[model samples]
Target: MLVEVKNLSYVYSEKTPFEKQALKDVSFVVDEGQSVGIVGATGSGKSTLVQHLNGLIRLKNGKITVLDIDLSAKKPDLKALRKGIGMLFQYPEYQLFADTVASDVMFGPLNFGFSKTEAEEAARRAVNMVGMDYDSVKDRSPLELSGGQKRRIAIAGVLAYRPKILILDEPTAGLDPAGKREMLSLIASLKGEEISTVITVSHNMDEIAEFSQRVLVMNNGKLLYDTTPSELFYRLDVEALGLSLPHTVRIVRLLKEKNIILPEVLTEKDLVAALLAYAGGRNA
Candidate 1:
């Protein structure tokens, strides 16, 4: 396993009246080179859980082993562990403050002790990988770019360090259709190219269904289901947890109710193909 969590639990404001249980015995394992999606409604602890994976949140209880290092250990080398786990929070672009785009992208590698020349080279590669022209944008201010451009540049910053695992929180939020598609495509390309494991938390079921090999559903800070995307969508109570089925899955179900039987579909491309095949069979 590339990551392991056993009986994990966390609390916010532990000693205050505002104290609340944010996570309850959440446990899951992620294999190397696997893509996993996490889905849940608001306040389901999805954010808190991923924070712990990279040592951003301290472990109050339970064991978390990330890249073979025990996160629960006292005085664990958090900096070292974090270097291997690239976490991009919601609106990560808002965190950008460098004078130049290249500087922002180079920040991670430079902080990790890469020489100036090597870091600049890494920055250029990462910027290009995110679909930006390094030569054109390297000197520009990250804050001056469009929303989608800033988001991609922020991702490039994380990529420059070359982490083994990449975790994204609501990566496609607040983007137009085209921007969302491009961003998701960039994220999907990370596996096998730069990162070994990809974990993303999103409310978009369609994106999750299309991207992830495995899916995890969370409800009220509890892990409700962990299975393949197909299996997870098949559960009767999925919507009761405040999540909707992927559009393709719901459409297929509706067709089946009308006796237009078809194999399960998760993506728009799959749905179109299935419908075309069904139509052809009827004409035959």
Candidate 2:
């Protein structure tokens, strides 16, 4: 297992009147090179759960082992653990602060003790990996770039150090459709590459179904379902858990209602192909 958790529980404002249990006995395991998508309604503890993966939130209760390191251990090397896990929170572009894009992206490598030359090279590679022109954006101020560009640069900053696990919270938030597609493509390309695991928390069911092989559904601070996207989305009770089916899946269901039998489809391209095949068979 690349990541494991058992009997995990957490509470916010433990002793205060506003105290609330944010997580309760959550447990799951992620294997290396697997892309997992976590989805939930607001306050479902999705964000709180991923935070524990890298030790950002102390393990007050339960056991979490990430990459064979016990996170529940006292005074574990959090700094060292974090070096192997990269987390990108919502609106990560706002975290950009360096004088230029290259400087911002190189900051992580430099802080990790890389020589300036090596750090610059890593930054160039990271930027290029995200489909950005390094020479064109290197000297430009991050603040001056468009929202989509800023997002890519912010992701590059995390990629510079080449973490083993990457966790993203709404990485495609606040972007146009085209920008969302570009970002999703970049994330998909990371699979089986330098990153060994990727976990994404997103509300976009289409993106989750399209990118992840497995899906986890959370509700009221508990994990309600963990299974393949096809299985989870096809369940009749999925909407009852506060998650809608993917657009393609919903369309397939509607077609079935009209007695037009079609196989499961999860993407626009697949839907088009299915429809074309159905038409051809009828014509034949």
Candidate 3:
């Protein structure tokens, strides 16, 4: 397993009025080079769970070990543990604070014991990999760039670390459709290139269907289901977690329900082709 969690639980502000349990007995294993999607409603503990992968949030009740480091303990080598787990938070672009894009992307490696030359080289490579123009855009202030560019630069920061496992929380959250599509493609390519484990947390079911091989549903700090996308999308309670079936699945199922003849359409592209055939057959 690439990552493991055993009976993990965490509460905020224990022994106080603001106390709340963020996770309860959440357990799952992610194999290396696999893409897993996490879905849940707001405050469902998705963010809290991924933070434990890098020892950011210490496991308060149970145990979480990533790359063989005990995150539940207080004295683990967190810096080393974090070095292997890269996280890109929601609206990561806001984290950029450097004078230039190149400097901003280089900050992470520089902080974690990389020489200036090596860190700069890594930053350049990451920026290019993320589809940024280093010669022109590298010197520009990140705040002055377009929305997609800023987002990419933020991702480049983590990519420079060259972590083995990548976790992104709502990577495409506030983007136009074109930008969202491009971002998702970039994310998928990362898995292909590095063979790294990826876990994406989001409420976008369409993205979940298109990207992940496994899906994990969370509700009220408990893992509701950990299964394949096809299995979970058909469940009636899927929307209870603030997620809905992919439009392709919904359309295909509705046609079958109405007794309209249709072939199996598993992917979005397949569904589009089926719909085209359905239209053509009717017209003919």
lDDT of 3 by residue, 137-228 (tens): 88889999878878889988999989888899999999888789779889988886964789999888888888898988899999989998
lDDT tens string, model 1, 30-103?
99989999989999999999999999889999999998899988988888898899999999989999999988
Can you give the TM-score per candidate against the true fold?
0.98, 0.97, 0.94
Model 1's C-alpha root-mean-square deviation from the true structure amounts to: 1.0
- Which residue pairs show backbone clashes in model 2? none
Give candidate 3's TM-score.
Answer: 0.94
lDDT tens per residue, model 2, 96-215: 999999999999999988999999999999999999999999999999988888999999999999999999999999998888888988898877786868999999998887888888
How does each model score on lDDT? 0.91, 0.91, 0.86
Winner by TM-score between candidate 3 and candidate 2: 2
* lDDT value for model 2: 0.91
